[model samples]
Target: MTALLLIDIQSGLQETVYYGTERSNPQAEENCHKILEVFRNKDLPVFHVMHNSTNPASPLYPGKKGNAFHPLVQPIDEEPIFQKTVNSAFIGTNLEIAMISRNITHLVIVGLTIEHCISTSVRMAANLGFHVTLISDATAAFDKIGYDGIRYSAEVIHQTELANLKDEFAQIQDTVTFLTELDN
Candidate 1:
């Protein structure tokens, strides 16, 4: 069975000041919502992963509202949620066990920043033997400042992560193509 794994689509990610001033893929959340809608309508399994940052100043701190799921992809009552503090959803969470128990071998992934939780989870999922399809348009990335003082644009970080994961970790697809394939 296939499942949608949405990682950290939380309100905290919207605060660019916390992550970066420039964020790539302004339509990422909208694309994520589109995929979520289709997944729900089709009665497919959907798993939500929330991040509770240990950093007190972080927007995703446990007591902060930013830790809440974004309104766009809020989970319904029956949908299971796995909250974690780490980058990979598989660690410190039963997400892998749950999917394994459900016989879910294929994963359709979408979520917040591509270079962080998204990349980590994708690689880990592949390493664990699940077939993964990461939706390119349904994920975003923040601009990063290199240790050498070079600044990388958000688009570069996003595309690089996708390129790194493509074929090796996951089959990367855009929202429209993924949705079309899902319908077919």
Candidate 2:
């Protein structure tokens, strides 16, 4: 089965933690919606991965409004959501078991923090031998400090991830191609 992994589209993370310059995706919400629409139209499984922040005050922390699923990325009644603390979605989660049970192979991933959760999960998925397709435009990130001690722009981090990730763990594709392929 082909599944869409909507990784960490939580309100707290976007609105509270990574606000301002970080939420600067050209069409942030819409990009996610487009990906969601493709999965919905294709009648494919959409798995939502949410990060459970340990702090109650943290956006990703439990009991916080920001820790909840963002309104724009709301799931249908039948969809499944996995709450996790680790950057890798498969860790301590039933995600792998669920996918295995369903015989799911191809995974379409989209969501926040391309430099973190998305990157980690994609690599993990690839290492586990899952065919992964990362939505370049659908995933967003924030300006972050790199190992080089330099502040990197969101686009810079995103592009770097894309460039380095290709053929390493998963194949990176543009959102337009993902959507276009859905039309066929």
Candidate 3:
């Protein structure tokens, strides 16, 4: 079975990490919505991986209002949701068990903060021998200041992250291309 693992597509992350409310890439939310729609239409299992932080003020902290999934990528009634505190979803969560139970072999990855959580999950998925296809257009990150004290735009950071993962940890593809083939 093919499963779509949406990592950290939370409201707080979207607003903070991906600049969801900003004037940049206005189509980002639309792209995410299209991804969700296509995945749902295929009857694929949609797994929502949320990062839960211990800090109450952190966006991902459990029970915090911002801990909720992003509205654009909200789960359907039958979809499964998993909360993880660690960077890798398989580490502190039942993701592997659930995948094994479902006989899932191919994982379609999407969502926020490409440099950290998303990157870790993709690498781990590849290490665990799962065929991972990352929808490049569907995943995004925010501008980050470098250790060298250089500031990078969200797209620049996202491109570097994608470059590191593509053809190594995952096969990066456009969301529309993936959905088109699957829809056919």
Candidate 4:
């Protein structure tokens, strides 16, 4: 069966000031909500992955308001929530075991910062033999600075990361196309 995996779509990641970076895709959360609606309507399995940063000064620190899940993609009762301090959700969590227990073979992944936790989780999911579909429009990325002091725009970083993951780790699709496919 297919399952929806939402990674690190927490309030902390929504603030660009916390990361000292600008983010692209202002409508990413909206798109994620749409995708989430489809998953719920279809009665598919849904899993939420939260990042709890170990850094004391980080916005994602435990007990902080920023550590809470975004309202748009908040989990309802019975939906499994996995917490991790690392980028890959499966590393310190029981995500893989949960998927196995439910016989979930396909994963539709969405959430924050395309080049970070999203990228890591997608790669690991594919390597573990699950079919992954990454919704491009349902994810966003923050601008990054290179070691040589070059700054890359969030749009460029987002697109580049998607390109890297395309066809290799996951099948990249936009929210519209994925919803359309689900409709039919």
* Candidate 4 Cα deviation (angstroms), residue 132: 0.5
Candidate maximizing TM-score: 1
Give lDDT tens digits, candidate 4, residues 1-184.
9999999988888789877579989898889899998999999999999999999888899999999999999999989999999999899999999999999999999998789999999999999999999999999999989999999999999999999999999999999999999899
Where's the lowest-lDDT run of ten residues in candidate 3?
17-26
Q: Tens-digit lDDT track for model 3 on 134-181?
A: 888877777777799877877878888899998988998887788877
Q: Write the per-residue lDDT of candidate 1 for residues 1-184, one digit (tens) a residue.
A: 9999999999989899999879999999999999999999999999999999999999999989999999999999989999999999999999999999999999999998799999999999999999999999999999999999999999999999999999999999999999898899
Candidate 2: give the clashing pairs: 12-66, 53-60
> Model 3, stretches more than 4 Å misplaced?
17-26
What TM-score fits each model? 0.99, 0.91, 0.89, 0.98
C-alpha lDDT (0 to 100) for residue 53 of candidate 1: 98
The segments of candidate 4 whose C-alpha lies over 4 angstroms from its true place after superposition are none
Q: Lowest-lDDT window of 10 residues in candidate 1?
A: 12-21
In model 2, state the lDDT of residue 143. Answer: 74
Comparing candidate 1 with candidate 2, which one achieves the higher TM-score? 1
| Residues 112-133, model 2: lDDT tens digits | 7787899999999998889999
lDDT score for residue 32 of model 4: 89
Candidate achieving higher TM-score, 2 or 4: 4
